[model samples]
Target: MTASGRSAALYRTVWRWHFWAGLIVAPFLLVLATTGAIYLFNDELNDAVYPELRFVPPAARTVPVSRMIGAALTAHPGAVSRVDLPAAPDRPAVVFVAPAGGGEPLRVSVDPGSGRVLGSLVYARTLVAWAEELHGSLMIGTVGDRIVELAACWTLVLLVTGAILWCPRGRWRAAGVLWPRLTGTGRRFWRELHGPVGLWTGALIGFLILTGLPWAGVSGDLLQRGSAALGVGYPASFRTHAAPESLPMKTALGTAPWTLEAAPMPRSHAGHAGHEAPLPTDDAGAIAGVDRVTALLAAEGMTGGYRLFLPGDATGVYTAYTYPDRPEGQRTIYVDRYRFARIGPEVRFADYGWVGRATELGVQIHMGNYFGRANQLLMLVPCVGIWLLVVSGVAMWWKRRPRGRVGAPPPISGTRFAGLVAALAVAGAVLPLFGASLLVLGAADLLAGMWRGRVGDAAASGIG
Candidate 1:
């Protein structure tokens, strides 16, 4: 085969994969991009949507954190999981309450200045919450998580193939390569539009995808374990203060720093190292006072919007962490519920090590939380660019596809099957979910091709 033949084969092979991968990834990417873009301003959006619950008048003297907790508990009797502190004078404090027995947590808004309960809403019921859930897992729990991960893994393949298909080939002409030409119509127009948008947005979108992978269920877990194996993953937070059977912090709190999610929940064990007493009962009144925890945190120079997770039972520790706009301010510290002693090593942004630190940095930037409004706007470019690619990709296929059949590009025989297999093999090895799906896709493609061949033979013989 000559150079033209190889080039044609490469184009045909990449185009086929680009088609399949896009089809698989398009819907998920749309949901991710839209929800993710909106969530970039989650704080702003929530405040705008529920000003009454989130806002309070500024006062010269404000009530204590304990008083705010007292107000929240008085309004709704339950165990306080955590409290979201006010970022500014006007923003109200939010106490998250897990109902008696077991249920979803409730967000009880309180005016810090007056120590009055403002309003209550289900934490899981808010708009941004729904958007977040859908973006993460399509609101269907574990199955949805797996699906989303699979979609994300395949998206990488889509990007790789798209890059090959859109790369500047032969002589670079500004008309279709550098920018879209407005003079074309139909498939020509879409082709011109798709290439330029993809070429410009590919790297950004790829960065987002790679960064966001750490949040995925399967790939994220592998990456976490891989990093740990390489001595760059696990951190000091993994050291348990007490029982090995104790719940993981992530399970107990529903969220933690990505690096510390699997760390054992710290307990307040008061003993001389060797001997430890039996765990105490779960009683709300028995735990340390919120004022003491708040005062201690203040003394430690914690001056931002921190989520103070109040202890539930005797063995529990008060977990305080800040969800700051930037990664540098990240901190997760625990205090003994009864003794009020600091428990375990405090996990900070610096303790994340190299890989963990890098992951967190990427995650912050991905969410547009690294640099405030400017970061949000910068991230929006890729989201808009993704939507543009989706539109142009579909348009291109629609204009050129045959009406009767699914318009997947035809396989070029005597061409690059080995190369295609090699690419898929490499992709699968890297992404387990994508690799598993590749087998299914290959089998399906084989069957479909055979079916098409039989139908063609039947037509040739004039047999239905």
Candidate 2:
């Protein structure tokens, strides 16, 4: 082929793959972008919407964490529990306790001053929880989760390929390409916004892909390894534990939503773990006297509302995570409940290894948590950009759809299908979602090829 022909062929191939990627994944992207935008400020929104449950009296003296836990336990008998301390001095300490009958998770909000139950709400809060459930799992368990993961992974590819296709052709200048002319018809208007907005938000979408892929099970592990190689480390404080079986009704309260139910505790062998002595029961009176940890926190400028969590198990330790805007500072720190000596701090931007820092920063940017309210507003740009991309992608696909009836063999070999297939395969192999999609596409292609071959044979036989 001539040079001109070769260039045309390359462009056609890129366009075909780009079109298919956008067509198949746009709805998924829409779901993700929209849901992610809502979730970006979930903490802020939750606080605003549920002020009564989230906030407490400014004049009240905060109660001990143990006392709050005790109160939560008293409310729900035989419930596995986990407590989330309020991030502010004037907010209620909320505990989620799981019930024995597999009922809805219980949320108990307690006033820190009087040790009195302030209010309780279920884990589900109507629309907010609905959005969360849809965003997190699509309410479809592992299958739905995997599907969303695949869509999220491939969205990066869509962004890249879309950007390439958006490159201006002929007389189209960079300015025209990057911004709408405002004088165009419906199609041109959509096209202009589609390209520039996508181009602008491409980085954020890519960041989302990187951060999101870490939840895709094996794929996530692989991504984590790659991140580690680049110097990223997992947050040490983000440890998972199996809940103890048959925990005391008191001990188990306030653990439900966080624990996923009571788990089988790891057994210690013979002399290593067997203790004839009874487990230390919660002495609320003794807990009240531990002034060292609270004083240290206060001295560190962490005055006011914070819960000092007491780990119920042998491996557990007391922990506290301060609110971002609060006086205690935005960092997460843990202290031993007994000794009150600081054990360690949870992962923060400063704590990241080189790659970990990049990852955290990227995620922070994506989540709108890095630069306060300004960052939150800045994120809206990309969220809207992604939504526009999805809309335009669907428009482009619809505009180019074949006019012929359904089930017709698609026109091929005109668009360098080989090159398109190769590019797609490369992307699919690296991205988990693309890989799964390729498998589905392969099955469809095989069936189509077989059907076409049979049709050709029948026509040839009739001619003979």
| Candidate number with greatest TM-score | 1
Tens digit of per-residue lDDT, candidate 1, span 1-464: 98888888888888887997787678888998898888888989988988889778986666887777768877887766677887688888887766665666678999888899999988588889998999899999989998988887877777888888887877878988878887998888989998998888888888888898898888888887787657576575565445366666676666787876656676667423322322222254533376778778888877548888765555666888887878788888788877776776677888776988899889999998898889889898899989989888888877788988779987886675676688779878888887888888779978998998899999999998
RMSD of 1: 3.7
lDDT of 2 by residue, 1-464 (tens): 78777776666756665676676677777777777788778877778877777777864467776667677768764343345656566777776666545667777888877788876777676456766667767878788788788777667667667777877667777754777555665666677667877777888777777766655654655666565445455443332222223232123323211111112222221123322222322444334433465676677665554544444444444445443432113354555555656654443445544555454455566667777888788877777887777787566555545676222224354344466677777877777566787798779977988888888999989953
Question: In the order shown, what is each candidate's alpha-carbon RMSD?
Answer: 3.7, 6.3
Per candidate, the number of residue pairs that clash is 0, 12
Task: Give the alpha-carbon lDDT of every model.
Answer: 0.79, 0.60
Off by over 4 Å in 1: 99-104, 240-244, 270-282, 286-288, 417-420, 446-464
**TM-score, one value per model:** 0.90, 0.75
**Stretches of candidate 2 above 4 Å error?**
76-80, 100-102, 173-176, 186-189, 225-232, 235-352, 399-429, 439-443, 460-464
Question: For residue 377, what is the lDDT in candidate 1?
Answer: 91
Name the weakest run of 10 consecutive residues (lDDT summed) in model 1: 273-282
